[model samples]
Target: MEQELKAHLKKLMASGDVAGIIALKSERGMAKPYLFADASELECLCLTPKYPMASVARLLLDEDGAARFAIVCRGCDERALRELAKRHQVDLDRLVIVGIPCDEEMARECACPEPFPSVVAVGTKLEQWEAEDIGAAYRAMELDEKLAFWKHQLEKCNKCYGCRNACPMCFCKDCELENALWVKHGRLPPEFPIYHMIRAFHLAGKCIACGECQRACPSDIPLMVLNTLLREDMEELFGYVSGTGADAENPLYTKEEMQ
Candidate 1:
């Protein structure tokens, strides 16, 4: 699969369809985002350690508005790019997405709901994985139980901000999490659920369930539990699924007629 993807990317670069191809390159046993400007660099290209390539693509595009680039994207990466485009963070017109479908094992590991991109340039597409509702037990608890649960989990947070840094959707220059009014600086745990609740509300209709937050959290504070619950509520109340497409109207941002 890696070879096939590398060949496809080499073709894209050779065809001059893009200025460069943004994908992961294996170096020192670590996979990091690298731009393949020359076909020779394709030899080092890899497809593991799913970094948030969407964010890297956005950064490159922002640096050079006229430069066109091709991105190696999984289902979540494509969705993240679509959402970013909708928010004016990226221009899809300047992007040529090289879609790579995730296998069943990768899908199950990530607990991915939709594991295949719209177009499969390489790798076989798998059926949507029905990720178990990890928040089931938490949801079943009473209000007090839920409160205690979060309190215990949140107390372990050391304010590393890894979750924010890893999130593809968190592109704000000035994050509310750092605002002294909400989360005081130099305070451990950031005054309990205040810090997390603020972030949860901010991502109410925007989190794409990429699981980067949970993966980045050092405290292992089931961040996805809160995010997944909010995602469900957003769908149930507004019929809006984040990162599904760029054209879908977000109900939270849409104006309603006054009755």
Candidate 2:
């Protein structure tokens, strides 16, 4: 698979279809995200347990690195990129997707459905699991239980902003989380559930369930549950599914766009 991906990327770069390609590269012992313009760097590229690729995609697309760029995306990353593209932050036509199917471990880790891109350049497709029941289970909890659950969950927060920083969709230069008005400056451990609640509300309909936030947290917060619940609600209320179609828009942002 790695050989196939490298060959495909080499072909794309050689053909002058894309100025560069954004993919995961290994630096030191840890896997980090980077943009590969020279084909020689493809030797450093890898698909691994780490999902630093999505973060790279976000950075590359947001920065507008090239008019045409290719991303080596798995299921979650593919959905995230599509969602970003739909929000008008990423140009779908400017991006070329090279789908990489997730292994069993990756699929189980994210509970991902459609563990490959809707469009594929390489790799086999995997079925995506429905997270409806997971969302319902969270919603079914008692109010006190929910409160306690979140409290205990957020207590592990080191206020690292790993979740926000890792999220492909959180591209705001003036973030509400940092502003004194909403998040209050000079506070450690944040404001408990409020910090998370603010994040959840901000991501309400925009989160693409990539699980990067959960994965990035050193404390391993189950942030995906909150994201999944809100996503379920957004789907139910607006008949919206993030990244399902090229032009489909999230109603929350669409309302704001109209205003």
Considering every candidate listed, which one attains the maximal lDDT?
1
Evaluated at residue 245, the lDDT of candidate 2 is 76
- Cα RMSD of all models vs. native, in order, equals 1.4, 2.8
Score each candidate by Cα lDDT: 0.88, 0.79
- How would you encode candidate 1's per-residue C-alpha lDDT over 55-111 as one tens digit per residue? 999899999969899999999899899989989999999999999988888777777
Sum up the clashes in candidate 1.
Answer: 0
Candidate 2 runs further than 4 Å off: 52-54, 61-66, 127-133, 255-259
Off by over 4 Å in 1: 257-259
Clashing pairs in 1: none
Best by TM-score: 1
Clash pairs detected, candidate 2:
113-128, 113-129, 114-128
Q: Candidate 2 — what's its lDDT?
A: 0.79
